[model samples]
Target: MTDSTHGPRTLTVTEDFAGQRTDRVLAACFGDLSRSRIKNLIDEGRLRRNGEQLGNAAEPVRSGSILVLDIPAPAAAFPVGENITFPILFEDDDLIVLDKPAGLVVHPAPGNETGTLVNALIAHCGDSLVGIGGERRPGIVHRLDKDTSGLMVVAKTEMTHRALSEDFAARRIDRAYLALCWGVPSPTKGEYEGNIGRDKRDRKRMALVERGGKEALTRYTVLKAFRVYAALVECRLATGRTHQIRVHFSANTHPLIGDPLYLRRIPAIAKSCPTDARDVALDFPRQALHAARLGFIHPRTGEKLLFETSPPEDFLTLEKALGSD
Candidate 1:
C-alpha cells in the first residue's frame, strides 16, 4: 500500500457560546489544538464563526455559535531520511517497544518542526497506529524527553492504550533510569520525595515545593562513583512528574552533569580529564540521563514483559573521556 501523511481534520462548532472568545470556545471544545494555533488559524481566515470570518482572536461568541476550522495533515511517512530514527526493541500485534535516543522529541510541539519520535513511529508503524490515540500519537502510550534515551512502549489498540495508561497511573509499570550526576549522595541508595512545581524565581526551572505542586518520588542507587566529581546512578520512578529526576537531584545538590538548565559551573571532579578528553567534555551538551529499563504486564497476554537498553554511545564515550586523566 502507498504511504501518505494526512493533515488535521477541519472542525466546526455547532453549539452556542455566548460572550466567549472564538479561540477560547474552540479550545474548550477541542482540546487538541493550542490557543495560539487556534488564533493563528482564525487570523489566517481559516476559521469562521457562524459564517463570519473570525478576525479577532478574542471576539466574543454567542449561543448557537457555529465555528469552522481547518486542520493540517500528518506527514507522509516516518523517517526515510536523516531526520527521525528510533530503535525498535520489541513489537507484537498489540504493542511495540522503542529504544528512544536522546535529542528526539516524543511528540510535536512548538519549535520542533519535524524529526520527532512520533513521526518516525508513524513511518515505521504506518496503518498499525490507526487505533492508538486517534492518529496524533499513533501507537504512543507514554513519552520520553528528546534528550532522554530509553525504552518506551507503544500501544496499537485503544484497549491496550487505556490498560497501559491505567497501569502507569497505578505505578504497576516499573521504570528505571540510569543517570550520570555530578556527585554522590551521602547514602549510596535511598528514596527522594517532594512536591515539584515551577520555580517562582526562575520560571524556566522546577523546584521542590511545600505547597501547591504535584507530589513526586524518585529512588536512586549509586552504580559507580567518579573521583569526587560525579557518579553513575540508577533511578526508579514511583511517580512520573515532569523533570522529576533532574529536579530531585538538583534539590539534593547533585545535579546531572551537562545539564543545560540545572548545572551552573564545571565541577572540580572533571579536572582529572586529559587535555583531549577535557576538550570533548567541554563540548558535550544536554543532561547525561538515560532511561535504561522498563517492565510491565502485557495488555493482551496478561504476562509480564521486561525491556532494557544501554545508554547511547555518546554517553558512554563522554563518561570514558571524563575518566581519562
Candidate 2:
C-alpha cells in the first residue's frame, strides 16, 4: 500500500495473511508506514473493515476483508521554541515589532513545520506569547510573504491582537514597500487600482480580476529609474489583498524584478541595460520587494508608532547594479 497522503486507501487481505492481527497486516501492506503509526490510526478510528470502524488495533484480519485506511491531512505540529535571530524594534505587553528577513516564514504550514518567525518568538517570549484565540501559536495580525522582507508586528496578548486586527481591517495601519520593476510607470506617480483574486488559470498565483476579487489599490511613486530597463518604486497600500503589490505591478507590465511567480520570462526592457545589470536583476533569487515602513497607533500607549528599515543588502545591490549609482 502507498502512504496515502492524499486520501484514504483500501487493501484486500489475502489467504496468505488470513489470521494475522489487523495492525500487523496493515504495517505489512503499508511498507512505508510504521506499525506504531498504523496502530495509532486504528486507535483514532481511521481504519475501517467491511464498512465498519475497527476500534481494536489487535483485531484479527479475515481472508479477503477489505481494510480502508483514512490518512488525515498532515497538520502543522505544535510549535516548539527554536532560537532564530531577527531585529527586535520594540516589545511591550501589547506587541513586538521586528524586522523579518526575506527567507523567514511568518508561521508554520503544511510544508514549513519549523524554522519560522513564530517558533523564534515562542523561544524568545516564552509564556509571554499567548496563542492566537486559543491556537498554540503567536498572534500574527498581518504577514509579509515568505521572501518579502521587512517590518512586522506580532501581538503578545489577545486584546492587542484584536485591536491590531481591527486597525488593519479598517486600513488605519500605514504601510509602504519598495520594489524594482521591469519598466517605469508612465505617469511616474499614480495608483494601480483593481480587484485581486486567485488567478483562474493558476491556482498558486494571484491576479487582477474583473470580478470575484477584493478591491486593491496600490499608490506608487518612482524613486529612481534605470534608463528604460527598470525602476525602483515606493508603493503604499490603501487596501490589503494577497500579492497586491506584485500583482498590480505585473498587471501593468511592470512586473517586479526577480519575482518568481509573476516575472515568468525575460523582460523586453532588460535589453536596454548593460548585460551585467540585467543579469543582476534577472538572477536575483527572490522578488525584489521589501516592507520599508509600517506605522500605527499603539494599542496600549495610544502614542503613534512607526518603524522603518532599509532594504536588505541584496535589494540594494540589485538597485545599484541596475544603474551606475
For each candidate, C-alpha RMSD in Å? 9.1, 12.0
The TM-scores, one per candidate, come to 0.72, 0.77
RMSD of 2: 12.0
Best by TM-score: 2
What is candidate 1's lDDT per residue for 198-254, written digit by digit as tens? 665664577787744568999999988776666789999999877889999988888
Tens digit of per-residue lDDT, candidate 2, span 152-206: 9999888889999999999999999999999889899999998876665665688
Which parts of model 1 have CA positions greater than 4 angstroms off?
1-83, 128-131, 201-204, 268-280
* Worst ten in a row by lDDT for model 2: 128-137
Task: Quantify all predictions' global Cα lDDT against the true fold.
Answer: 0.74, 0.85
lDDT of 1 at 240: 88
